[model samples]
Target: MIDQELTKIKSSTVLVTGGAGFIGSNLCENLLNNNISVVCLDNFSTGKLKNIQPFLNNSKFTLIEGDIRNLEDCHKACENVDYVLHEAALGSVPRSINDPITTNDVNVSGFLNMLVAARDAKVKRFVYAASSSTYGDHEALPKVEDVIGKPLSPYAITKYVNELYADIFQKTYGLDTIGLRYFNVFGKRQDPDGAYAAVIPLFVKQFLNHESPIINGDGSYSRDFTYIDNVIQMNILAITTTNEAALNTVYNVAYGDRTTLLELATLLKKHLVSLDESIANIEIKHRENRAGDIPHSLASIGKAKKLLKYNPQFNISDGIKEAVNWYSKNL
Candidate 1:
């Protein structure tokens, strides 16, 4: 279905910000596979060159080595682009807590610059990477788009602010926009070597190295862990959907389920042990819970299903198996 939609816009060009990062790089690869031209904008920062190396030589792929924090860079990348997938931003709640100024500068200021450039360029639509962090302290069992809570961290504030700015852009400037609130997305090419590394990749790397992965709490905390393919689908749907009611709204991009941290660790061990039986000996450790971390997260993907026809193909177990296989071969 998505392939058919892409065929209709194969002649179009897309500008993907932070296109060297995990999610952004995947988006570029999928778009290029569909024969769509892509302009990738990245300053490296947290994004790695290796992620985009495969696409660098493709004729349809163009790399714009620049920062989104600069309006000129944003404008340069937006030039003649038919659509914009704004994935550039400083991620991680702890990183934001440590340096709120930089987080605000890139996530907030940089986002604004992209909006202005997209509006000025008169792009068809602007689909961006919003975050489940926007749900913040809501305490809802299954998070909905309309009911949001106060942001618990600087990172959450930045993502929530994105939705606010996007709304204003649609109403005030007549630019079409869609915000996808991603929930703990993980998969191939995800970095597992950083201080702010996501849990799944981090644990997989640690187990492969015979190191203990320390859980922040009792391992009871859970999350709606989504796969990268599902996220890619949402972005494509947001860009392709001609439904007027779907525009200028936010949708939770998740698997519509939740998994406990302990369950996640156990599953990782089970899958990795299959690759190398010796990994079964690696112990899982526990530590105090990290500050500003949510206890549980689940998303109501009903809106995405009803509006954009989002049907997530990967569940947690299937996603973990694939992720473990990738780490074994690549890492």
Candidate 2:
């Protein structure tokens, strides 16, 4: 999603939780590029130092080694901040299925702590990462903003709860908040080693190593794999949008294009091979479908288009090409 022209706001100090994660790190870099001050809070659980290593010397960026689960840590991070981008979360459906309690602790309790801390700090706005999984169990062809279904997993529940809590916080405490329901975000700095690593990075790394990438289920499951730049645009718009009509709402942040996993791997391999022809022989393995995974996820960004003036610049092919180039140089 893109916001054409944003009003220059009064806030300079910004806090980004989970700032070392893939999307968070990109957002931090983009903000720094715009000459904005940033306070990054992270626990290094799933996030890594390498993601934000390039910014260690930037005077505009500050890193706080803290966990959002602790209110004290959240409070510390919120101080002197005008906006809070809450990206900290224990993501991954299978990971949550394996350990729902930890997921709940981080995604639910941790989110609440951030909200409370931001409210207490009198932050100008609080924009947090919501997920397209909130549309869970709904088999709609293209997910709209208003309609949603029951959360299918602990991760989904946690994200949906963020929206709920944001709404109540807005009503009860008068905190301005916005939620961006991200749909299958993937791009640069995305970790490829974790057990719950996203498909693109995992497949990219696997193919790079000349290893067979695994595809779950039949070759038909598709997703709206959004680019990191689009997500950065959404965050910038959400934080800067002063339109009363745009406040206190969740917008689907995606490219509105879907690609099946099988197709994705083939495309990735094509790109990787173009870079390093030796990897062209990399094969793909199919396995049983994962539990708690939606068969297809497609988002209708009409709401964002109409309300936030959102316009996505890259479709899946364009995004994948950029992502593959990043991985080629970095991973």
Largest lDDT belongs to which candidate? Answer: 1
TM-score quality measure for candidate 1: 0.99
Model 1 over residues 179-298: C-alpha lDDT tens digits?
Answer: 999999999999999889999999999998989999998999999999999999999999988899999999999999999999999999999988889999888899999978888999
lDDT for 70 in candidate 1 is: 95
Instruction: Tell me how candidate 1 scores on lDDT.
Output: 0.94
Residues 140-257, model 2: lDDT tens digits:
8899989999889999999999999999999999999999999999989999887898999999989888889989988799999999988888888888876889999899999998
Instruction: Give the C-alpha lDDT of model 2.
Output: 0.90
lDDT (0 to 1) per candidate:
0.94, 0.90
**Error at 43, model 2, angstroms:** 0.8
Candidate closest to the true structure, highest TM-score: 1
